[model samples]
Target: MKKFNSTIYMSGKYLFVGMLLLALLGSCGNNADKTNDTGKQKREQLPAQAGKEKAKTIVFFGNSLTAGYGVDPSEAFPALVQEKIDSLHLPYKVVNAGLSGETTAGGKSRIDWILRQPVDIFVLELGGNDGLRGIPIAETSRNLQAIISRVREKNPQVKIVLAGMQVPPNMGRTYASAFRVVFQQLAANNQIDLIPFLLENVGGISHLNQADGIHPNPQGHKIVAENVWRVIQGLL
Candidate 1:
């Protein structure tokens, strides 16, 4: 009887030891699985963050002129700007957000959303549509002022290049003079880079203009790109 009792006790001891070992192995396996999952999540997130950090963004905000209205996308001045930047091996992306017929107020309203994206530079071109529509020049100027102010407030380090526009001479001398002065005065007061008359040497030239006599053709876009490059290259 004593022998049987001792044998029973030994059996119970071995069972306990075996169960403990199994439990320990199971726990270790679970911990390893958890570690692998965590590592995978971190690896997945790294690429997205790296892509965001690596991308350099530039926004072109303006009216039809910036849109290259009636022109091919590849031949547009913004695309040309991209080409030039690529040729120089600059690490940046240019986003053309120009809406045909957009006035200063239109630009001001949409600027908040536009700025939400990563923008290193803003090629601001507006007021041309306002001038064409015969809107009050003061109102146009005020809207432009607000746009610039808001952009600066949101991104203190962002570079700004303002593109100037001219009212057609047929739009009365008073209106034309006021329209031309708006860009010049704003640029002078704010100490901003200004491209005097975005359509310089191309406007009214039937060869450069499209059928509408307003927007530039492909060849004209090349000239426009040159004008913008002169101002923007220095900024970069």
Candidate 2:
């Protein structure tokens, strides 16, 4: 009877030990599954966080040419610039802050409003109207300088590109010549990029202009976009 009792005790103890081991294994497995699940959740969320990144902005501040006066807004040079940036998958947003008949003085006044938002790259395209109106070169120069100073004050890190413009020869050789020199001097003094002549290939070309023979047609705007892209591409 003692031998039989000892055997039964041994059997019971072994059974209990086996059950405990099984329970421990199952708990470990559950913990491992939970860890894997947490890892997978984090991996899935990474792309969502990356997609939230905001694109930098490029503000095109100018007059009728930048506004696409005769053409559709989509046909404007600034819009076309946006298309180019999108095509390359570049992280940039273009804002066309153009107003028709905007002169250097007007730009100086309106710049404060435009600067309320962030500006990564600022393309200045004013002074053309000033030239057309035969505004004094000194006044135009002062206004442009003031606009540039305000832009820098708002954001010292801002990259500026000044669009050079030319008035009709009828404006007078001395006046037209002085007007053309203003852009060069500003670019040099301000140490910013210049597009030499904004309407390079399209300016004097009759077919490239609209009925007003001042603002560019759609095709002309395309060429103008190319001209701008050439200079700004390097900056980007």
Candidate 2 deviates by what RMSD? 2.2
Off by over 4 Å in 1: 1-53
- TM-score attained by model 2: 0.88
- Candidate 1 local Cα displacement, residue 71, angstroms: 1.6
The CA lDDT of each predicted structure is: 0.90, 0.94
Taking the tens digit of each residue's C-alpha lDDT, what string does model 2 give over 69-146? 989999999999999999987889999999998988889888999999999999999999999889999999999999
Question: Candidate 2 overall Cα lDDT vs. reference?
Answer: 0.94
* Cα error, candidate 2, residue 42 (Å): 2.3
Q: Model 1 reaches what TM-score against the true structure?
A: 0.77
Compose the digit string of candidate 1's lDDT tens values, residues 76-186. 999999999989877788999999889999999999999889888888999988988899998999999999999899988888889999988889999999899889999
Q: Can you give the TM-score per candidate against the true fold? A: 0.77, 0.88
Model 2 regions lying over 4 Å from their true place: 1-11
Model 1 lDDT on a 0 to 1 scale: 0.90
